[model samples]
Target: MQVLTAVPQVLSYVVALVDEVPEAKDVKAGWLAFAIFIGLILAVAFLGFSLVKQLRKAEAAEEAGLYDPSDKKPTPMPTVEPDRKDDTAQNGA
Candidate 1:
């Protein structure tokens, strides 16, 4: 487990080594930047999804508890339009 923790440090050192070589410096920086950008995007997306899921779970728990539903207003579900060529026809146009 301790060895696993040192992987990032080892990888960083390898990148640093490549960066020291004039011919490989640009490649090193580009790869490093790409990896960081992808990691950031994934982190943000995961965090946002986790937060929404937690909120939903909390709401469900509240609904199942000894609390009056009328006391707290529930969030409305958004209306989604049907994806039909003739919307009226689908709904008896």
Candidate 2:
């Protein structure tokens, strides 16, 4: 397309304009950004350590029989005995 072809010329003109401009001020990231960056790194490291610890704990719990296996048959639920009910009250004694 013609637009794509004109992009290089426009970019060259922009580069020339930028080259003519003088540096006004020097900008720095400063200490606050550096502190926040370090804090984030420490947080991520802490989270990674916590994740590994919890995973180890879960594995230990599983080994100690906390988690039941799927292949084994489940225990039957307790049934209510019909004989234990008050028959007279049900019959409007």
The estimated TM-scores of all candidates read 0.41, 0.52
Q: For residues 28-74, what per-residue lDDT tens digits would candidate 2 score against the true structure?
A: 57899999999999999999999999999998987888887874478
Candidate 2 lands at a TM-score of 0.52
lDDT of each: 0.86, 0.88
Judge candidate 1 against the unseen true structure and give its global Cα lDDT, from 0 to 1: 0.86
What lDDT is reached at residue 59 by model 2?
A: 84
Writing each residue's lDDT as its tens digit, candidate 1 over 4-92 gives 99999999999998876556545545788989999999999999999999999988888788567688877999999886687787789
| Pairs clashing within candidate 2 | none
- Which portions of model 2 show Cα errors greater than 4 Å? 15-25, 70-93
Error of 1 at 56 (Å): 1.0
Q: How close is each model in CA RMSD to the real structure?
A: 18.2, 18.9
Runs off by more than 4 Å, candidate 1: 1-29, 66-93
